[model samples]
Target chain A: MAVVKEEEFEFHTGQNRPAGVPDAIQFIDVHKTFGSNQVLRGLSMGLPEGKVSMILGPSGTGKSVCIKHIVGLMYPDSGDVVVAGHSIPSLSDDDLFELRKKFGVLFQDGALFGSLNLYDNVAFPLRQHTEKGEDEIAEIVNRRLSEVGLGNANEKMPNELSGGMRKRAGFARSLVLDPEIVLFDEPDSGLDPVRTALLCELIKEVHAENGGTYVVITHDIMSARRVAEYIAVLWRGRIVEAGPSQELFESENEFVRQFLAGESSGPLGME
Target chain B: MNELFALPREWLAATGEIGRFMGTVMGDVWGGRVLHFFGESLRQAGILIVSSTLVIWALMFILGLICGTEGAYFLEANGAPAYAGVFAAWCDLREIIPYAFGYMMAAKVGTGIVAELGAMRISDEIDALEVMGIDSMTFLCATRLLAAWIVLPFLYLAGMGGAFLASYIAVVQQVGFVSSGGYLLIFWEFQNPPDFLFSLIKAMVMATAIVLVGCYYGYNAGGGPVGVGTATAKSMVLNLVLVHLIGMLGTQVFWGNNPNAPIGG
Candidate 1:
């Protein structure tokens, strides 16, 4: 990590500890602006392959925007996002879509197709991307549903399910394709503490079993403590500090220390 | 000066944007890229058939009855009650039925799509589809356009049959100014197969525009439920304007110079 200017980013030491593994995803000086509001300003970071990494940031700190860039749903204004060695911005539309197959994203709301039940929602990617017959699809869909503890709820529509159930169903759908990189955008959002813990446990269990790169975008400190092996604390579109979760929790930097400690009296304030 | 032209400039910009969007969707369909999602297209076709068919036909039937009654009374007042079928033929086949079909499509299918896709957009369902490696535009919009192309012609033709039947009933049975045989003879004499084909073309054009406009507004909808509502309203307004524009142009292009009536000849 490079030290930024003294006035603008005084607390930003930009200390990014090496993951000791090749990056599965990289944001190279990426900058994104929506109208006059710049969301990501020179955001450069990397997520280690084959690990559960969490992008820990305060609310409205471009955390979810990072996930979009990783999956090619958004393009940066001035920089590149490299995923699995492919430059996302440079790829043609066909190639971009092909590269997206490596990713499975769970949106905040689950975003399950309202028209499809849990069973069909989980089966949707398979039905569109695979030539497998209904029997095979059902087998896979049932297994994924059971893994999410929604086996009995397969026939339920998305609207019929609770928020936690919908998120779990979305998790099942994300994993159905057996993607190489799975991104969860605020998996703990709109859930009780117990359900959030359980969802985090599910993430850990799934990561351990599958052995793929997993990135969870969230501001939940408890979730970060439980699920993230690698942690990136971002603020103002730039990474303040990022490293192994244990190291990040023990950091001496003011902003990282205060944020990871969930303290209010620090350089961070309501702006 | 800039302020003076601002509204028209904004309108031109929006029109250009819509044109580009529609061009992309049209290209996807024409270039057969939409066929990659042919199953989705078929699903949309089925939905159109199930959800919109009856409503459209019912509206056309009602309009047909109005046309028939109006034509019958007008011809009878002119001491040409026997020529009632000629009025009914032109009304039902050349003008009223097509306009009725456009009106119903704008009200029912077009607004329905705007609401459905607008909800999807606001809820991040469209984003989910994109992240899933699916081309959301082709899956969501182009497939719909293809579906409309596939299903609407048949639906329109069937609705036209309903309209024709209603016209016959209103003229021969309800109005009773002309007998069934007299109405049948003049009606058959007035409209040939070409007129039906022309009318079908008009209605099909309106359907295409309505579906495309619905897709544009819905797919780009933002701001949340209120935004979706706004988009639905905007799509309805644009669809109605387009319906009337296409209707007027169709009439002029198809039947302006030659009324295509046996009596006129």
Candidate 2:
């Protein structure tokens, strides 16, 4: 990890998963482009091992793209995305898959299967990845469902559930596998402040409960303040500012100041 | 004209397109999903029981009826004792129940497969699965394929029952054949069970092929909702056509021109 006259920070999720746990989801000189537009230009950031690393950026700032590389969903045009212990570029399909089982992710939309009842949706990963008997699956599914405070909602489908419930259900599914890393694409989107606060609390609870790393990608400033142990401020495909919540807030960087202060005119572009 | 390619080089500088397009497919059919928790464990166990028994029993009962009736029908038409019932049971149970309608089930389940996977891709749900360390293909494809394999033959048996029902109706309606007489007559001529068994094997093979192909197209589907729909349609049409072709080919390769071989008429 590079220290560029910024606040050096580290936090733990309590579990020292030594033989199994990883250091960081690392990216080195990563680059990506879409035709004429460059989405990620030399974006390099090591998501901290276990603590929540909230990526704060405006829309279309490649936060989602950054995580996508970590999961090997998209290959960077150049450079590397190494997660856990495997160099993503060097991994075979099977190896990539094995590497991926370490992380859990929550999408912005929740992306629940409409055809599946909530119970089945939560149990989907278990059934797909294991040969456990129904009795065993039911127990785990029930427990996870209850953990999200939706044990009764198991019979309901995604469509039947509210937006908040759906996201929570997605959260439950992510935790089902007990992954080492959990990534949230946008936890605060479409959520009310109270609900968002509850979500933040749940994220903290999840981290505390499971002791796994979490990378939250969000534009919501309040959320960054609420749940983040570390923050990476992305601007123009470059992390223009980053550090502890207070460090970045109290920093002298004009870019960070403009962004934090919500200024319209500054280093941050309107477009 | 070739220098047009050089334009990107000029703009982006020396671009390294790593890993040349090798035609070699990840040919290995590797890995399957294992249930982790109690509910999930139970659900997987149930999929085999529910999907298979329901499909098979329904199909088998339908086939029994078709055979009984059709045998009687042939017997009545020929004025032979229970001969039509015999023929019906022989033909429907041995061939129609296992292969003909098996092809239909393959189509039913294959189309379903396309839609499920297609929807996932279009909705970015698959991307979600990936980031979670969940292998979407293994989970989705394995479960669906398991269901298809489990249920298809059963559905085929159900079709067999329909045939049996038709045969019985046909036989009973015929001018002057005793109901029990037809069954008895056909029973006397029962040659071998392998005929039915072979057809069932063929059905299983066809079902596997249909499912794998459906999963392949569905998993690889890129377009979106429209693409998923297209995939479903394509998977169905292609499955039916391919199953038909395979059936014919299987007939030729496995049972063609052989006397006393349990081949379809």
Candidate 3:
């Protein structure tokens, strides 16, 4: 178990990590519109090479949409989303597929293959991306499975696993490619608090162990406080407040105060 | 008062939904074309190769048995020459089975592929696969198209054998004058080698068209499970229609715009 610093996990309300740390991912002036409904309006952020940068926002603020562009699933209407250096839209399909090797994303639900058991499910990306023989694949798969604390549940189907274990399995999949930049699209969603707590612990521990860049999209204030070095509150597609988590947590921004204080009377609507 | 206009609106909505699903279908086809440019679809070709051996042997034995019996039966009953009866049976073999079997294979395998992919689409698995960097088209469509092209000729050979065997068996064993050896003599004498080749060539061309159409519809099927059922129906019907058009066009090329090719006289 590697050490995760207490200061590194402080609460912030906007995107600003350790400066001069060198960005592994840089999004500059990115605009994405789906048939005239503008999802991202000039969005920009940088993920420092070996730290966790959490993207906190309300629903429909284009969290999944943002990650899709990173993987080249959808192209930005304008501006740049450069990953490991190359801009996304300029890359061809084969180039995009090759570039995706650096990414590991845990989708909201653990999207394991229904036909495949847990062992095979975790082994899928390795088989697709690498030409490793079965013995090597088995070794890698078991090591990842144990990392998420599911070493003994190798033969179970996804349906048989609990919500917590499924998410853990999804996390296990993210590490299969040995990705340098891990992107989590709300890892805490729909999980019980106990599970969420364990997951938050795993996220920090994995970061410390691997020393890779992390981008998490979450609004769970507790998990945000637990794991994020810096946090950005994406309200209506603008970073209302962003800085070091500790500084922002102690700051005077109305939205930040209202948000961190967990008040119901703020501008955030039920709609 | 304007509620009556809902009927027309519903119809237009249906049209638009179909239009969008069709756009998705065209997208699959375009992707398939790019991959297929390097060579023929290996899936279709494999199907042609495997079905060729089986259909050939099965149809040949059937042709021999049927022609022998049928020729004898006609010779004894109608007093027509046994050779005439065998030629008539040959006419059926050279034409019917080749076209019908092509259509059947298209119906069975073509509809099955459409349904399979359609279900995957309905279940949201397709979207999931895309996010994972797996190009679903290259994996699914390439295999199907390759199998069809590779296996079509084999089916036609079997069709030929089946038609001849059935005719031979009915002619001799049921009626009696055409001996077993006589049936073989009649088949070789009356059968033109080009006719057999022509049947296979037609099946080969039709198989490619059928498989492509099947994959195109299946990959983009709408309305989930119901959409899959609809797409399968559409692919089968479309395959049948395309086969007719290709069959006619193939006949024209061989027969020079005549209904029948200028051979077997």
Candidate 4:
């Protein structure tokens, strides 16, 4: 619980525009606090369209909170979050729901309904939102399950699956709607290194085929290195630096260098 | 001093939150989205029956036996054993069965709902529904509430039957203190439609309160597994208090002026 001074945290406080691409999601001076503990303070970043951007941060740095704001789950206390050009916190209930239709979120624990089997879990959005016939739903669900390599595990309950399998099933469910923006919150939190690398590969391969804006929030440097085209390093409720993944990796900022290099000693002391 | 003020403030805030939750549930019900979750509601009803019905029936049956045996002893001692039938009918049909059913429902179904929804809340499934553009309230709480509404009246009826049978066995068969024909005659003489209706209404009202309290605590559960357990406990405690309060209020409103008995006057 190191409380860094607000002035010592250096980062841009507006949308970090890419060279020529429009951002699919933008946060402008977003500030959020729970009780007296502020989690996100004047944080700003842009996730470019049709690119895999990772918001890399240590634990308790509001990475997951950022994802929640993008999906309109949590509104900012005082700033703006725009997803796909729709300003969140300003949308009415109906409009917010309509906005959320464009998003697919894969929670860390999969978040599949415990009562529903894997097939029904994947088919849930389609069944709720569309008048598609059962045969069509089965076809779409089966295809998505197969895409995540869980085609055979359709009848199994969520608790029956291993951690990796559950994450895959969740990934399948997230893509079932063909969402324009997919958010992954700590997709590699509990998996072993081998499973993590495999998941990263699957993400890359899926992004290559789907070509949607993908924002993955993770503290895993290996995942950030392997999957990120753009990277934003958040520290102490602010972005320390952000840019193209290669540029961020080769930056001169002491905090960014220490974090990316996994060094223990730097401006970020152990708190 | 701060603690005293905070307690009432928290209670008022919780009441407001429950009111808002009920409003959302009613809106979803009116919007026809509740029908979309009807199958899920029926599934939950089946689970509730399997989990809570037998225990409730058994509890009521035991209570019936105790009441019947005790009333027969007192009536026989006073040379008015025939009036034992009226006692059994009144207590079982009007007061005991409904109150016991409310208690059982709070202990079993209410706690179960809290635990299930609390676990779902902690696991982020509710937020997952929001991200998928589904109304989690309608899909989760409304479905469970509807299931309780549809199932509890019939369950109460079955429990009443169990109570009457237990009373008959205790007074006529097991105790042999009264003739079966005599007991049945007086029981039928005293019982009427309003007794059944009011009891069902009481059970249904208690069921609604239990479901609402359970959903409120569970859906808003924070922290983690320990938080979920605490929510379950809190729901049960609130439900217990509400069940008794509703039972007393219902008894006053439904049967205060009109006892609706054949021989009471």
In the order shown, the chain A TM-scores of the predictions are: 0.97, 0.89, 0.89, 0.95
| lDDT leaderboard ranking | 1, 4, 3, 2
Q: Residue A24 CA error for candidate 4 (Å)?
A: 1.0
Residue lDDT tens for model 4, B1-265: 9988998999898789888987787677667778977888898889988888889999999989877887788888999898789889888987888888888888888888888899999999999999998778888888888888788888888888889999998899877778999999988888788778988998898888888888888888989999999999888888989998998888788777774632323
Show where candidate 4 strays beyond 4 Å: A1-6, A11-19, B1-4, B30-32, B259-265
**Candidate 4: residue pairs that collide:** none
Better of 1 and 3 by lDDT: 1
- The model with the greatest DockQ is 1
List-wise, what DockQ does each model earn?
0.86, 0.42, 0.25, 0.84
Task: Show where candidate 1 strays beyond 4 Å.
Answer: A1-6, B259-265
By lDDT, is 2 or 4 better? 4
- Across A1-271, the per-residue lDDT of candidate 4 in tens digits comes to 3243757565434224363588888889788888878899877777888889999988898999999999988999887998887899999987988778888999998999998999999999998888999999999999999988898998999999999999999999999889999999999999999999999999999999998999999999999999999999897777777778988889887788888989998777767
Tens digits of per-residue lDDT, candidate 2, A1-271, equal 2222223111111111122334577777777887867777666666667778888888997998987887889898888887876788888877787777777788887888777899988887777677899999999999988888898997897888888999999999888888888889897899999999999998988798888889999988888888988778876566765566677777677767777777888766766
Error of 3 at A170 (Å): 3.5
List runs of model 3 lying over 4 Å from the truth: A1-20, A114-117, A152-166, A189-193, A219-222, A243-252, A256-262, B1-107, B119-136, B147-191, B221-237, B255-265
Candidate 1: TM-score of chain A is 0.97
Candidate 3, DockQ score (0 to 1): 0.25
By lDDT, the better pick of 1 and 2 is 1
Better of 2 and 4 by TM-score: 4
